[model samples]
Target chain A: MILRTLRLHRFKWLLLTGYLPLSLLAAALVGDPVRWEDVHWLDVFGEGGGALMVLTWSLLILGSRPAGTVSNLLFIGLSLILVTLWQDNLDEFWTIPDAQLWDTWLENIPMPVGMAVLTLGLVRWYEEQRVLMAQLSQRERFMREHRSIDPVTRLASADYLNQQLAIELRRARRECSPVSLMMLDLDGFDLINRRFGAHEGDRLLQAVTELLLLNLRDGDLLCRYAADRFAIMLPQTSEAMADLIASELTSAIRHFAYRSSKEGERVTVTASAGVALALSASPEELMQRANRALSEAKQTGSGCHAMAG
Target chain B: MQWRDDSLEATWRSPDTPHLPAHHHPALLIELAHARGIPEHRLLRHTGLFPEDMRRGEAMLSDRQYRRLIGNILEYDTGGELALVWGRQSLPGHYGPPSTQIHNAPNLAEALNCLHHWRHQLSPLLTPLWWHNRQWCYLLWTTAGAGRRGPFLVPAAMAAVYGLARHRLARSLDWHFLFAAPRPTSPQPYEVNLGPTVRFGAGVDMVVLPVEDLYEPWPGRSQTAFTAAAHEAERVPALNGAGPTLPEVVYQSLAAHPETPAGLDDTAGALGLSPSSLKRHLRDYDSRFQALYDEVRLHHSLYLHQVMGLSMEGIAERLSHGDRANFRRSFRRWTGLSPAQYQRLLPE
Candidate 1:
């Protein structure tokens, strides 16, 4: 089945390149026997160009779409119309024998029939596409607003944290309230990756991010800092409250059991957390203090919590 | 778990694992090996299948290959009732004949009765009929011992049975059908093969036979065959064994200790049965033990992840996994989503 799909995709590209050139060559070889002036060349060019524009528009719709029912129908319809147009264009060059009245009917009647069918199919296709696009747009909007989110974990990144910090800092200053920051670093994360594969380690990080998000207050903001570190911003909270939250976060990480995929081996993961007060201090200063406290916690060993002095 | 019979272990370790006899059916071969304590891999290898091929459970082995493998296993297993157990497990499409007969029957009621009687010829994992509005009717049947095989096996088997039954009926009747299940995400072969309206996670498998066809007469002698097939099917034991069996001992042990190295042979030996016998026994119960273990583990893991609100890393830890990625894949298989997506499904 996988091979068949690959072949289908391959054939689509092959047909695009191979058929266009072959069709053009056939048209060139079957050049007009009558002088170019004898036939209605201008009318042929105008009609052909109009058909090409319609065909190009349909092809664009097909190209921009993901494989789906409406796209497939549109593609089939476009192919039929294109085939009919090709036959119509062929009449400008070659004159069939007198006995072949069927070719003349095929050349003239099929194009209009094909065009009508294509137009009908496209209307249905457009309606279907609109519905799908609406649903897709919701997801797209979510993704766009959360572009700074880690796709694998759906957690905010460091850049998001910085932006949120700036916005919240202004709000806190305006409201005349305190906001605090917490930094958490998973201890021995490198050792974890070394023991298990790096993939498992990444999973551990993702899980940790989720855990932090779950534990955060409604107004709190969380972000992934480094590979194994995270930062959280607590609004309308004091240093004492941040200290309590940081301790809870540290306990959660300490209790976390990271599992291995290849073999179901469970390894306990611990984290060291640091809390710093945001008492009218700049974001950078608060961040620096939190980092310092985090370093202190790490130095103190596994599952340690440190508060800015 | 101590190895009860050293000879069975020897056979498993031996280079030339016993193969199924030529005349034996594929279902019988599976039953025999499962009954005798022969590992699926050993039987599969003797049939010219590599260990890797066993992983692809959905891939159908030809009847010829199935027969050859069973023949080899029967060659070496002489002392046990494993062959009988194997026979019970190996019955192909326990519903194959009856399903076909049912389709040929004139009326839906007759067809339903035919199915009810003959369903036992296959594995007993399914209950052929259930009480619906005070009348006995074909409804959902749960596969026992499913945990031992793999999480996907029972669902897959259920799908195959429905598909096969639908194909047989389609041959005789011009009617549309739909399958409702929760796991299947896309509609391709399922739609084409089972008829449109393939809904997933629908809670159960059911056939809404055309209401008009309820009073139609049997087309041929399908009614007689269905009755005879049902009686014969009753004598055919459930895939695993006789009587009410507990969850395979290995599953309990593994559930108790998910991190333990409870491979196929280890669990079989622990249960005082051969691996082949255990597998066959599981089939009768409408399950395989290995699959059960995985299911239990996954269920527990998911419970911890969602209900207990455990972190993925923490859940992985309890499962004895060293990493979360492996947990994510296993969880996805269990619930058709990554851990993050599953978390999203939970109410805030």
Candidate 2:
């Protein structure tokens, strides 16, 4: 059994290693001469590298691409070119054995035929590579954007919010526009953890995140600030508008049925939020003021919203 | 400390289902049986194991039964090697072919790779191949039925094979480390049997042989035949219709003290059931309880004696003996040899 397993692995390697060498030798035996019957020797020299250039280019192509149909096609093309060069090189060495001109026939037809087939393969390969690269680029872009989003709630994280805040703050300053920050924290989150369990607590947080996102305006940005806390950045909005949005968020959380594991037990979940105007302060300072008001609201009771002083 | 407290409570409140014995871990039982030369049927009889019950492969014997069996074996077997040898042989499939393949490998590394690749075919439930300290190689094989035996049997088997293979090669096993992560049991057996020096539960079941052993061509096929003879040296007939059922007095005594020398005379004297009459009743169930008791006690004793490190005196006490001397005499009479001699023959 062990020997068979070893042989199987060895067989795979042997297939991979032998294919290229055998292809190259076969091509060499049937390739056409580099110096064509009608073309001048100086034309080949003027090309600077001739058949060697093709060899170098094929090596480069093999090195750059992963193993696939494109590589296989390129390898076959290169092998044919190499074989043609080898046949042309042989003409400089041995005389023809028969008057039948078998060497001329071997040197003339198969090399060009192989090159034509290889060219067709290369065209298909190029088209396939183009589609593959497009898919790869789209995947890379999605991954890059996904890094900024929260995994659990699919909302933006604090880092993303801060970047958006900086941009909105700059635009507000330039255009004499206004922006407001609304920070909300869940009430009795620790109590919920103690009562139900961490898994349920996580589920409740996800529910609240969805509620807040639904309550916000299309232009507003919602982000998770800390455990059981979230911030919404509303652009071109006044403190009064932010407070109204905060109230809507509070009401939604209050009405949400956070089901407990215990039968017939449903907890009325609520949030305390605070709104701060970015009228005469930087985005960071505005965020700090909103956080202070949120803390104050949380201390007072559930469903309370306070404005930054 | 808090976790331990929780576990203790959980263990106490846990259901006493036949599948989850309070004391005997099935993995440990199989391990001990395999380690000791005692047959599986004998081990089963002592533990009150019904082959049909174990069909699902999760049936467990009570802790009391496990402890009694281990204690009995230790008291009866002094050399402490039989359990280990039994463990090696009970491993599913023939070890000879694999051992041969590994022995003929160019190097220890290649030999281990071979064992790793092919071990699954031998026992599907057995865990994948694992290494310990770069010297020892370990593979786990699930028994015919799952959860019917403990992992202690694996280490015993490994230790035995390591010792025997080294001896066969005429070199020290040269293993620097050994480890296994078998299912947990209350009283650990590997610690006592393999050695105080070797580590257990580091990761997986493993045997630590010298790296050079891979290059050594396995001793000729003749060595395989010799090993087979040594392995099968203690073959005991499966006790069929040879033991009492639970309702009978002899059955009660045997269950109460599995390690008690359950001779026909002794059981007959206690129950007022003449030896002949008792045998007749046992025949109805297709078993004699006394023979069942001996088989069970033999298996239990080997495990306790070799794996659990229980002293002979302690085992004798558990077996309900009046004294240690009597237990020794009885043990000798049952097996045709002294407990110490039997233990010495076990794999180290």
Over B1-348, each residue of candidate 2 has an lDDT whose tens digit, in order, gives 000011111011111122232222244445434333455565555666665655555455443344344544544332323345334333222333444444444444454454444432222222223332234333322221112223433454465445334433543243533443422321123322232245443332345444456456654435454345434422422111112112223433543445545577776666676788766655543344545565446545544554456778777887646487887876775555577765543335
| Top candidate, metric lDDT | 1
Q: Which docking category, incorrect, acceptable, medium or high, applies to candidate 1?
A: incorrect
lDDT of 2 at B245: 19
* lDDT against the true structure, each candidate: 0.53, 0.52
- Two-chain complex of model 2, DockQ on C-alpha atoms against the true structure: 0.00
Count clashing residue pairs in model 1: 72
| Candidate 2 structure lDDT | 0.52
> Total backbone clashes of model 2?
49
> In order, what DockQ does each candidate have?
0.01, 0.00
lDDT of 1 by residue, A1-309 (tens): 344443434545466557556765655564445566677788689668866876676656655665656555566566656666766666676655646665566556756666676777778877886786454331222223455554434566565666667777887888988778888877766456445534576677778777776677666777665456677888789777888898898888778776677787888888888888764677767777887788778678889999989
Candidate 1 C-alpha error for residue B274, in Å? 81
